[model samples]
Target: MNVSLILIILLIGALATYMVGDKFASKIALLFGLVSLGASILLLNHYNLGENIGLFTQWIAKPNISFALQADGLALAMLLLTTALTPIIIFSSFGTEVKNAKTFYALILFMAFAMAGTFLAADGLLYYIFWELALLPIYFIALVWGNGDAEERKKAVVKFFIYTLAGSLFMLIGFVYLYQKAGSLLIEDLYQLNLNGTEQIWLFAAFFLAYAIKIPIIPFHTWQASVYQKAPTVGTMLLSGIMLKMGLYSVIRWQLPIVPFAAKAHVTIMLVLGIAGVVYGSIVALKQKDLKKLLAYSSLAHVGLIAAGAYTLTTDGMSGAVLQMIAHGFVVVGLFFAAEIIFRRYDTRTIADMGGIRSQAPKFTSLFLILVLASVALPGTFNFVGEFTVLYSLSQVNMGFAIVGGTTIILGAYYMLKMFQSVMLGETNAKPFADVTANEGIVLVVIISVLFFFGLYPKPIVELIAPSIEEIVNQINRIK
Candidate 1:
């Protein structure tokens, strides 16, 4: 009857995809994506302050947990991002020869259901359940359908699985500790419970480690590049576009308010690590020859800055982090999609193997150029807006960190342009390449439009998120 119900219907439609023949699996996924998008739009239209919708509730006496679902501005934003990208990822996979197409499509839809539950779940335990639930399908999707050396792909998936699971166990420990203290697993209840400085510190540590691994912050990022490189483009898109944000979102939603004292105490350490990640990731990306590996490192650099911004505890920092999450999600998806197009055309992802493609593929070259500029945080692009705000917020904490972190702009531009020149500028090194196909063009155009539209007019997104961020910040300050 309402948007939430429609979303549930879409999830059912996705599961029903299993019954459809393999030939129509991709179409079914696309249809589910469309319906999910419509549901998101309807939800947005009906959105209001303090609005909470519950789909289910049940008592769990042992830990005082309850099964529940709720919606707010943050949840809505994440839902919108997830639904909007599913169709594009499905569309982009159209030409690929997926052997178990029906099962593949079913997994994608199930992943959507899990992701939606992650955003909507009101109970911490339920949220964690959805969080872990979201990973299995992706792991299989990557391992089974992934490209590159088969052995390497298997290793990558296993490593990714093990690393993420290890980190999540720590987070679960934090939740159990919280349940012991608060006698409830509901997020609202957790928010209301009082916590001591020492307990908060340990809890925050557990939560931060888990989220850092998911975000793939510098030192914990060994598994990401290989995973990104091996996974199919659709898998990579979903991982970067929607999954990475889970960590950043959890930082804002869980760690900050729940462990305010510890956050305040360790803010400097967080800033130091964040700045280090920013510089380190950018520098490493500069040396990457494979496009997927390059983008994977680039994502690390961007998330580093976002993590720093979130830890700043300033309104600008938190709000900018959220916007940056949305901005980077779109930009990175576009960039990866561009890489996919290039690989499809050249049958290679190595930068050295691509050259002078601009002459024969002007349209592809032009679009690639736009995406590159966006990646480097050009003034007119969404990345610029997010990065600028994040840096400004960092400046308020320590000008030195801000300056060091800000160097990412110069480094980003250098590597992105270097990549562009290597791949798109020189003489045709391979068989004459054709322009982007209609499906590819549609995906690129939509992404570009989103980048430009948001870059020019970010006020709506800012307005939607500001109040919730303010409330969270207030809660953090109150706890302090």
Candidate 2:
């Protein structure tokens, strides 16, 4: 099957949209995104039946690097997530007053291409290329089309770019070493390399450094809140909803698989750090008065739990991490869109200023409540399936880890309820709080429906990803 065709479609659409100009760029981008999603679904169905979707060519013969792209279970799942979200992101942007709409919409498609390329690249150098490619479009999007004071936005975007790029340098170094040791940049070759403990240790640190910054775990998270606050809703959505997953996905795909010894040896400490982000992020969220920043911290906590799950090195944990990524991706997009909807009407993000929105706009309130519930992993929601599985995995490892990690549940509920009560449940405001518009309603409906569908019947995703999770688990277990 044609794995890279989606990338071609998205990239070509980006260029064409630029040519068509702003008046129609949004519609064209959305159309391309929908087509890409349809193709990915077909590939996913083909993939589930145990067929390969691979593209290979010699790119650098001397160093044994290839322009290889493969969509195994893990890659397909991530690719599907990227394609599925792109249309919604574009559709969600339908009402925004983004200057140079053609450029803005085109960049979104380019970013999607880079993300898909990152997911499908089966060669180390190629993967790194795609990974780095993703950072540029989002940077410009946030910088050029962002909200707030010009000086402040520039500072935040600059910090974000510098921090993430610095991390990428380390990942590149890690890849270089692996290439030298294995004599090939192919993922398969690196996976099969028999490195000693010392080499694995350094390589693990190198790769993890990049992922950590992108994941923005604990201290590295400095760039996150400000960037989210400063960015336009579209920028915030792309960063939180999809870009962050790149780091988590790389952890599962590259770090643990190629350097299992280091992963296992350091698993406990790494897992501890991850759990710390969960507790830390939630506690911070509880203190935020700004709705967007509050949601940012909430995102941090959810992803921390997901990261902890990945580091558990168990089938359940890995599977849960994958599922949670998809769940969280959709939920966060809806949440941010809600935030934007609120700001559009009221022109303020301060929690203190938001009240009686529910009384004014019942439908919007209901959808938001559902997203809030899903965010906290309420029972009968898709989040619960993944969160429960992850906690079970940690508890199997040590009840203590589960105990610590589970704080997000309590902390999450506390802050989300607080946000809802403050923003939606008060006396009706004198200011207007209109219901969700048709465009906005469509996006939210799709998000909620998918969450519920997967919540009730998650077996298809679990089954599709089971083999990849099993393969990853076996790799980690084989470490010695």
Candidate 3:
């Protein structure tokens, strides 16, 4: 079947799952997710380098926008990540008991649609619509089903909503200004528009705020820890695994080329902030007792390095940032899922409360250990491939920045291994616990296989994304 037809069927399946009620909704969602994954793979296989496919058109008059979708290497990579994770997220939810399973499954499918739209959209307004649309379902999912105290959940959700929305408003202003200047909402048109240095600076700041809040660089990251701590395991998985990359992707797609001069001029300060965030997040995570909170801080550190790499504008840096985005998405989800399994068994998330779990759950301990190693960027894991590329790229820009960024590996290992030792080792003193269940084992095994497979053979992904990075770099060079 054609791409458009496949998308339509998936959308229908999403709605149908919502209508089908609780009993079979999850199964239907899983079925549609698999179909979407298949379609994404087919699109990737058929992807032609230097070719653009115009999927559809909308808004003929007044700005000349189109419902256009293309399968460039960058878009395809993100599509693969999204599709691959959807079913895993769905399956992970098997351990969760939601009030209305149908609504829950529907939300997951709808999130998939929104994410696909964000990657595929070729128009600025359309992309922004999908971007904002993606936030609502997740907000509800977290607020309704999140763990922790009731008030804390509410506060976390509200803080996340407000922070993201505030940033989004700036993005909206930036896009509107682009539309006014370029007389079109097409992303390509914006790239060609010539703006003065002043305009570029202002527009860049506006766009930066939006993406930073989402990637959540240092100061803007206050909301993320609590939100991650409060969110249900599946919710946390989706937020960390797939959603955060939306911001990183936007920085590459929208901000850089459109305002290359501004980005280049202020890249030093941005790099400083990135380095600070990396160090600060790692140190803070080292002290976190809650597993989710620790993971949240670790995510902050990872994205800070990614933001630093994006600003470097070097080919290796950009490509590494992209690869890291995909790698972190998978690795973070696996870690969070492992945390969820522990939480489910012991009914607690505090490290001090968990002890001797490895004695009772050997498979769980083994899987968690592998995931921890991946998180710390051990060799033969995808995280190692991504971090090596990113750090090497950063070193090309500044040895100091690379040195600071490298500290994350040390701090990451300190915290992760400490957590593992606390939870997975020591004398048996806790209530009875089961080993990793079949579903959990499957989820983790898939993640591990992908992690090692990509780690050992990352050339395919590098080849796929390099062309787009080259295109973007060429655009920035034109401005220079």
> What overall lDDT goes with each candidate model?
0.87, 0.92, 0.87
lDDT of 3 at 210: 91
Number of the predicted model whose lDDT against the real structure is largest? 2
Model 3 Cα shift for residue 359 (angstroms): 1.5
Off by over 4 Å in 2: none
lDDT tens digits by residue: candidate 3, 355-382: 8988788888888899999999999999
lDDT of 2 at 66: 97
Candidates 1 and 2 compared by lDDT, better number: 2
Clashing pairs in 1: 356-426, 356-427
lDDT (0-100) at residue 343 of candidate 1?
82
The TM-score values for the models, in the order shown, are 0.97, 0.99, 0.98
Please rank every candidate by lDDT, starting with the best: 2, 3, 1
Best model per TM-score:
2
- Cα RMSD, each candidate: 1.5, 0.9, 1.4
